[model samples]
Target: MKVPKRVYEGLEAVRSSGRTNMLIVSDVLRCARSMGYPETAQWIEDNRNPYWEGIFQGFSPSD
Candidate 1:
């Protein structure tokens, strides 16, 4: 069976840019949302300003 075009495109992008940490990132984003973190999503992505790196340490970024 053939994969959908968007999935294929996503795979291609991952293939080229090696962003294997996407799953971890997505999970963190979900958790942030459930906790009512912020709006733009980018709102919680900051480490030096808003969200600290320590806050994200528990989330393993391993694939």
Candidate 2:
């Protein structure tokens, strides 16, 4: 799926911060909703990719 630039950037920021935990996702969700991007937040919430999980788990050093 093609994600909006803002959503992509937000997730990228999260990933870049090396924080892939649920809490960080939660923050993104909140921001997305407030920013009128609920779908973006929902998409992030729905995604359960191992890559993302790995990032969340601190498996990727540069994530």
Candidate 3:
């Protein structure tokens, strides 16, 4: 899926920082929401593994 430049860059940064999978997902969702990419945010939410609840824990995107 294609994401906004900032969201892509943010994910890259999160990866480069050696964040865990959950942290990476959280950051990407946060970026997508802050940038008005609700579809992207929802896609991430929908596509994520059900077992990884921590990935989206406490995150409620306004999108």
Candidate 4:
């Protein structure tokens, strides 16, 4: 799924600020709901496998 730039930016912002996985997911879900994208929020909530991983793994700090 193609993520909107705003959503990507929001998640990136959260990560850059050192937010945890839970907070990042919460941010995404809240953003999606407030932006009238319940499907995206629900998809995030429902998909356990690679859900949080997919959202956050890309932003993991590299050593």
User: What TM-score does each of the candidates earn?
Assistant: 0.28, 0.45, 0.41, 0.46
Off by over 4 Å in 1: 1-23, 44-63
lDDT of 2 at 2: 41
**Lowest lDDT 10-mer window, candidate 3?**
54-63
Candidate 2 residue lDDT tens string, 1-63: 345566565555554555445456577577667656666577666765743664445432222
Indicate which candidate wins on lDDT. Answer: 2
RMSD of 1: 13.4
Model 3 agreement with the true structure over 15-60: per-residue lDDT tens digits: 4455345346676677656656666567567757631452344322
Residue runs of model 2 more than 4 Å from their true location after superposition: 1-23, 50-63
What's the candidate order when arranged by decreasing lDDT? 2, 4, 3, 1
Worst 10 residues of 1 by lDDT: 54-63
Residue-level lDDT for 47 in candidate 2: 69
lDDT of residue 50 for candidate 1:
32
The runs of at least 3 residues in candidate 4 whose Cα sits more than 4 Å from the true structure, single-residue gaps closed, are 1-23, 56-63
Residue 34, candidate 3: C-alpha displacement in angstroms: 0.4
Tens digits of per-residue lDDT, candidate 4, 1-63, equal 334454445445544555355445777677666656566567567764555565545433222
